[model samples]
Target: MTDAITLRESTPADIAFLQTLYPAAFPDEDLLPLVRSLLELPDVLSLLALARGVPAGHAVFTPGTVGGHAAPVALLGPVAVLPRHQCQGIGSTLIRGGRTRLEAAGTARLLVLGDPAYYGRHGFAATSDIRPPYDLPREWAPAWQSLSLGGDDAPMNGTLRVPGPWCNPALWA
Candidate 1:
């Protein structure tokens, strides 16, 4: 039987685990620093998923704007699950929990560059109109999906910019 998974706001104690988990997903040195900067941003939302008191996965979301609307949208990314924990629904649990928290806080949208098959199960759909920043790969582009909590009319088209080091050409590329 699987142990219960718990989702919680990331604390300083979780930083070490995050550092370790990040490289597993994004091996690029530039990406790490950029991720670090995003985690430190005031508007960023960081979450950790644990199973039986051990870290299983992590997720980060940053504030963004879409289609000229300044709503509190999130750039979901760098979510990583421990290799041993894959297929156990730990990642999905974290995502659902995080979305619930963000929705409760009045967030209007959640955006991500990930697998359509995976994120789609969580209500994420690629926007026919929206586009991510120029630095992301085309494959990643196709994976750009959004979940609108503010009804179907929510704006999806617009530049999605990460709040910190992600803006740096060196880091973004």
Candidate 2:
């Protein structure tokens, strides 16, 4: 049987765990630097999931804004789980935990650029109402999705304003 998974806010102390986690989770991509920089940014929420006291997965949420939405907004990304921990609900636990914290903090919406099939299971739906920081490829447009966090449901037809590190067009592509 698998060990119980525990969720907690990530601290600088977890960087070493992440150094190895991200590389293994995303072998072909170089997302380590981005993940490291995000952890040091103010207003960014990071979560760590541990299995039997060992780091098993992680998720990061960063504040962002849609041009017209008045309430707070956030972006969910760079989430990863160690290869061995792949389908044990750790990723879902991290996401739900993050959503709970953000909603408690008055966040209006949470956006993510990921597999539609996966995020859809978590209540995320494709959204054309709010645009991402940059134009996504036509095929990947469906990957841009959002979930309303019980704040304001008013239409937000504007581009997302992300932080400096997320401004890189290369990352958006």
Candidate 3:
């Protein structure tokens, strides 16, 4: 593991890097097309982690609506770090940096389908306080964690809706 890594907002030039890194993290059949579609959404947030100038991981955040309210929530997904870079904090940095940027932009909450053990370090928790649009499997639901930028009272519960092709069931599956 390198002593230092760089985190940045993915630029148009970084699409290739994302394309390369995502598959390494998630070998799902629907991921590539989902990536392509997510790139076109106006509310999408994409980030890249670079180690020694080489892309090591990628993370994507998409705006979601809950319970018919326009809650400024983000759905984090596909946070992928190269197998070699798994435990070196690259994933954590990418997630933290992305959340920081979103919070800076006035986003209120973020939702993620990932390990609570991993995300909990960043103030994420799985509370029955919020509900997603679709029913997530029990195992997956336990991993659903939320982080609030505006404090605990911020509207945290609602159905999550992603724009465009991201709404497809296959991608969420």
Q: Which candidate is the best by lDDT?
A: 2
Order the candidate numbers by lDDT, best to worst. Answer: 2, 3, 1
Please report the candidate that would top TM-score against the real structure: 2
**Model 3 clashing residue pairs (backbone):** 66-159, 67-159
TM-score of each model, paired residue for residue: 0.84, 0.96, 0.86
lDDT of 2 by residue, 1-173 (tens): 24498899998888899999999999999899899889888999999999888889999999999996677899999899999999998999899999999999999999999999999999999999889998899999889999999656877778999897899999888
- Candidate 1 runs further than 4 Å off: 1-3, 25-31, 135-140, 150-152, 169-173
lDDT, candidate 3, at 47: 86
Off by over 4 Å in 3: 1-3, 28-30, 68-71
Error of 1 at 152 (Å): 5.3
Q: Which ten residues in a row have the lowest lDDT in candidate 2?
A: 1-10
lDDT of each: 0.75, 0.91, 0.77
- Tens-digit lDDT track of model 1 for 105-153: 7778888877899999999988756666655665566587889874645
The TM-score that candidate 3 achieves is 0.86
- What count of clashes does model 2 give? 0
